[model samples]
Target: MSDLKLTRRQSLVLGAGALFALGTRGAFSQDATTLTFWSVRLNTPELQAALLPILAQFEAEHPGIKVVNEPVSGNLVYPKFLTAVQGQLMPDVAEAYSYHPLQFAALGQMAEMDDLIKSWETSGRLKDVVNEFAYKKFFWNDHYWGVPYNLDPRAIYYRKDLLEAKGIKPPTNWDEFQAAAIALNDPANGVYGLSFPAGNFHITQHFFMGFMFQAGGSILDKDGNLVFGTTARDANIRALTYLTDFATKHKVTPEGIGSWDTPDAHTFFQQGRAAFGMGTGVLIGEIQRGNPDLIDKIGILETLQGPAAKLTAGFFNPMFVWNYSPAKEAAMTFVDWFTQPGRLEPLYAANPGGLWPIFKSEFDSELTRSQPLMQEMLAKVIPYTTDFAYPGTGVPEMGVIDGEKMFAAPVNEVVIGQKTPAQAIDDAQAKMAALWEE
Candidate 1:
């Protein structure tokens, strides 16, 4: 099939027209339900090939439903989704980052899956298979709004040979982490102890949040209220101070890390310029392609422990049913079928690490157990993993804050030594409060 290309503006216009036509035509056909699926992952060749076949299989089994697959560019997905929501032209099934559906759920734009999920025969099995952390992140207002799709868990990737050669053991806590970093630093040899991104990007936000969580604090409270400036101030400051100190005080990370993005840090590790780096499993693939020799020397560890907790960041892009869609039942059917281990294993195999399973059954399957690396990675992450918004405080506006980089700017200021960690945290909290008020 030829690609269905639609610019952002054109998508909005066409979406609105489609809504009008649907309304004027009255109810959909009685015999067949045609469900439109909008997904950003389809932009990739591997994902497209893996998903298209599964969708076709779904159509074959359920002859009464037709699936219309639409691929949207990652950068344009949120904006176009907003436009569709405003125009009442939402797709029947849509893929979204965890926070995106929360935004829609707040507005009652997302369909609640609690009833459907509970009534399904596989509900008990699903609960058993899926990591509670993975599914719970989608819970809001006491209802499940999204189906867990994939997991991206962050861990520390270190040079096994370098550490062994230095007679240094892997770090488990902050002090040991710092000591190891300092010991591993060799500026004359063009090696840094650690590599991290400090730019105003998603990577920066992610790692920063992991640090904050490890420090036993979060930007928002469990009640979804802004707490960074008041209740969580000290913990937030401590986390930020520790991160900035890597460059400003410890001097173990690269000199210009305050301006580096994800690629910069990843490249530093890939080229053997850094002994330790923090990232998702995808980094393994990039290393295999760019520095194949380093593959055997790489070792993974859970994020280091802090005074209060040991935590790391995990990301999920979920599949949700839009409330405005006429084929909500059909969309749920597809989601239910898609998440089953039998159907999902192939998709996971097509893109290892990139689509880590959220289900325990899948985790225990031969497909996962066959690869010890994947198994070890999952074991290290699942227990301590959390979403970007922290665990229980994912409010609608958090999505807006993340998208606009409201949290990143202040963090960047601290990293560059333009502001103290305390000051930056206070400023970020104030800015976030304004957003919540608005």
Candidate 2:
């Protein structure tokens, strides 16, 4: 593996270099056609047990092809991939964040998948495909570059037992959510209303974007222009004010949230220190590992409504074949096989509430039916889910905007009282615009 530590300037330089790298002609194993795959699932016994067997089956069915699953952490996927690109050591296939394929595609490092998808549609296999939002995440520059692996929507997870004890129903909209958090918040007893990151991390950006969308504001309009501080200024201001109020005015979240990231928020929630936590189904798996007893007491809510709209950021972390792969057809075959319901169900069951199905019909599968909680979550989240490129198809600059912490900085400023929401938004807009102007 390549060294994971690289500066943002280095990453950009490597990204530009990827456009010139030639393809590797053969598999890492000379004896067989092996597909080197990078998976986002952590390298754990349970995940391996669920994933390896499916690869074995694919190998058995194909007779001459082998699939290797290399587990990588979610945060490191993009950087490691960029390193691979710079070295011309790209994997045959890899899973990445929802925004990454577009970046890779724009750099000419990712293979276009339109033909393979068309083949599936022609063969009537497209019915099992994920919904439009998931598919659209990888669609940019008039081509499809990735396949949706799972649906990652920003849903709320609350302490069911705690809410019940307080005689509160699960909140559905922003007002109800804030009220519930305030009413149940007891800082003296080490219980707060909400647990979410406000740090200079992508998790913070995700949360901030969700609120902005819920308030009917978008980062870019349909023409791919920055609008947060222009056309959608008021909605973004409202969104920022509400988000910071949790830490400043409402005083419901834990102290020093501006310094907290995903792990901090996860630990705070797992210890039963908060009444509400915001994340994807991944939170369920985290709680199950850190505090199994809390599992039965947890309730997942749909993306809450705001004054302007009912919307949340949906992440369709997709799998894409590197353009440098010699065996493109073989890689797609494995990609298609691994995403089938039968193969996906075992992985889902093994993780137990961690992975949500990208295919809409899988919600009614026996696996989902057996787990009542998953069924409830999918039903609610699907309706409110929108891609990070809301109100537009998607743009390559969107990845840069997210990677550079352009959105989180503004929210951090407002929360820390260094600037008003309007000032923060304006400064962020100026900084972001300056990036593309170069």
Candidate 3:
């Protein structure tokens, strides 16, 4: 997700104080059952072209239902969501961030989805076909709150051609990953082994979480208690030190990464300034557009193996309904129509590897088979993909940790030489623990 540059407090004010301004959009229908759909993907022209037709078709098929598309910026959606919920003006259906559904459900703002899932003709397939681990994250408070639609799991993307030229096999573990980075590092030529953000942004938090999981550490345990400071302290410190070393000790990643965001890091790989980087399937499409010639030369690793474990974390974009929506049934009807088999072809076709298949049936579909790059990439990374709240159910506190950019604070301090890894970890633990208590 791109940075919105809005602090959590700023978003709270927007949600609380600016709600009256939001109601003036004049998009909602008066005579028909209107379902206001909010989506982050709708911000892009390609996605808009793909969805507008389908929404139009839906309105044509359903007699009295009107569908309105409201494109929300990815980073700002959570704040807008909070305001909408507080003001009782929530969109009928929304594309929630990976952790938003859990948090909103905890606040009693999201509608339960198990009953809706049960009513589908492909209910059995829908339950069985999607990635089971990603599916279960929505099962909070003994009920499901959201439906998983898109999977954007993170993986290490490397330049296969560059590795072959240097005779370096793809790195499977952190030791090998760093060794490869050092081997490939040529700063005088403006090339680095890795491109990562260290700035206090959500992308940095995302990268940190991947390494934390890789080191067999987690913020919370299965019981949803703070474990980062207690049980996972050593692993957490090791993970932080390893990632920060890219800029500080090794000097293999770009300098001033402390000021970079997602696009900055991605541009390094897109422009061939970095030999290896970590990102989601979105990288595939962006790389295709930014540098078409480098397309086939890129390869994806399942995830780099750490000393303790080898899994990765990423977004499992889920669609959720608002409990207070008057058009709840109409909203769900649109969701059902949207998720039906072969219905998602336009999105898949518009951006081949940008959005992943949430249904197992989509795997063997001709559209998927047509794109060998997506097939090879998805096959490698999807198996190892899991949500951000590893080992623990996603609690509301986890969302705050991510939204407020807590993970990046300690990381930035370490990168800038303000504190050692242990000290930074101690500070982060105290701050997060206090938040949890609140």
| Leading candidate by lDDT | 2
How well is each residue in 185-217 modelled by candidate 2, as lDDT tens digits? 998988999988888887788888889998989
Candidate 3, which segments miss by more than 4 Å at Cα?
Answer: 1-31, 119-122, 126-129
Q: In model 2, where is the ten-residue run with the lowest total lDDT?
A: 1-10
Ranking of all candidate structures by their lDDT, best first:
2, 3, 1
Q: List pairs with backbone clashes in candidate 3.
A: none
TM-scores of all predicted structures:
0.89, 0.89, 0.88
For candidate 2, the lDDT comes to 0.77
lDDT of each: 0.74, 0.77, 0.75
TM-score, candidate number 1 = 0.89
Candidate 1 residue pairs in clash (backbone atoms < 3 Å): 129-360
